[model samples]
Target: MPTNGWDTHMHVTDPSYPEAADAEYTPGQHNLSDALSFESTIGINSLVLIQPSIYGNDNTLLLNALTKLGTRHGRGVVGFDTDATSFETLQAWHQLGVRGVRLNIKSNEVNLTEAELQERVTRYAKIIQPLDWVLELYIGMEDIPKLEPVVADLGVRLSIAHFGAPTLPPIGNRTLPLDPYTVAGFQSLVNLLKAGKTYIKFSGAYRFDKDPQYRGIEGIARELLKFAGDRIIFASDWPHTRFEGLDIHPFVEKCLDWTDAAGVTEKVFSRNAHELWDIPLDK
Candidate 1:
């Protein structure tokens, strides 16, 4: 790990068992104390706690964990309904060290429509812009095309989840699907990076590859890194959802190997996180 490194992405489940299945995945169980141990082993000095979808908009558990972890070791990314979360409430979260908001559109659990989606995105942009917080998208790659125009229209900085959600085998072939809309979305990400309006997290290789070892995903990551290495950041996606069988450290090590440092590893591992999330470090 780079000196004073921070893991830009992580999640902690709620402490209470509102639902038995959800409770199993709680941060108190999978992260919290466990994360400190993992950080020690990995040499990451700081971390960001993203609110897991299991908790929906109730960020109390995540916030509690952040409070316990303390500012020196933690920051947060919360989830909220743009229609429901008022500006004052958002400002409070910002003061609590929340540097970003997560738009978990992929799960479809929240069930938003095109109009509602656009409205929420706009509202979030309006609220977070003054604080300079980012909007993080966790959705399918195909869906990105539908969402790009709104993001561009809003003039807010955005982060696409999982490396532009590249289409590879078991999803789409290596060449990427030829759908014009998808093509436009992928190009939109490149354009956004070129214009310095967006960023991508080089995380969750397990989510992209059908193979457990993540053999071919590196090509997609390199493609993004080629265009926006400085803007790209790395993440462990700790307690990887549905991928508990694999060792997290080895996956992280493989990602490090795939990138080959190329002089960009430092940025991916630490520097970009500092710039994007305002993570404090000794350097």
Candidate 2:
């Protein structure tokens, strides 16, 4: 198949970094060359390399890869300390096709006080606002309520990572495991969609459920699709972290399956991504 789709989430490992050893999940022996090969196989022409927790704020590896790919094959979603990164630095990154920054509150294994988190997000908004970059949040499901006001206050485009990072058991329920809190959070996503302030990537199903077939996981994905079809974007989470054992193709296929059901494959797989990230699509 000819590659034409855009993968909104993936990580490329930089062996040169000493921190690679500490990674609980690292992309398997795959460099940018390997990633391009895999993307070719899956019919993915472009990808967004998210900053993995292992790399922390050291984005040298991701930056180097983007430099090599030169924005044709790759773009980046980087992580940085707002205190450390200057607005001019963010502007330079944007010129290189970085349209968003990753905030990994959950995987970084650090809990922030509500005030501290707010301060950090607020500072980031100040820097990123001028560049028109969105904030991509990787946080736990329970944290969404606290995050709502931060997102509202910042007023930058927001993208939630990994289906709001719901707890594994409810995801494992294999039926529509509905809880009041989860229902409320799902509704919040709908509201964000309606307001045109947020987008959610349908990736990381493996993190949500161990079953590769993703039995019960489909229900949650379907519900999210129902809430916001065009606002949804599909991703492979390729070389799927912590679950490298699973084939990348199946992950992409499952996302396609959910998009098909939602009747938003065109937008989710291609259109919305281009519009959001400013990547060019084949006409």
User: lDDT for every model?
Assistant: 0.72, 0.74
* Count of backbone collisions in candidate 2: 2
TM-score of decoy 2? 0.88
| Backbone collisions counted per model | 1, 2
Q: Candidate 1 regions off by >4 Å?
A: 19-28, 109-116, 171-185, 281-283
- What would the per-residue lDDT of candidate 2 be over residues 1-283, giving only the tens digit for each residue? 2245788888888555657444555445767887788888778768888888888778887888888888876779898877677778888888787888888887756688778777877887777887778888887766666666667668688888887776645543534443323443555556666677788887786776677677655666777777578777777777677677577677677877778777888888888777777687752
Measured by TM-score, the strongest candidate is 2
lDDT: worst 10-residue window of model 2: 172-181
Q: Name the TM-score of candidate 1.
A: 0.85
Model 2 spans with C-alpha error above 4 angstroms: 1-3, 20-28, 168-184, 281-283
The number of the candidate with the highest lDDT is: 2
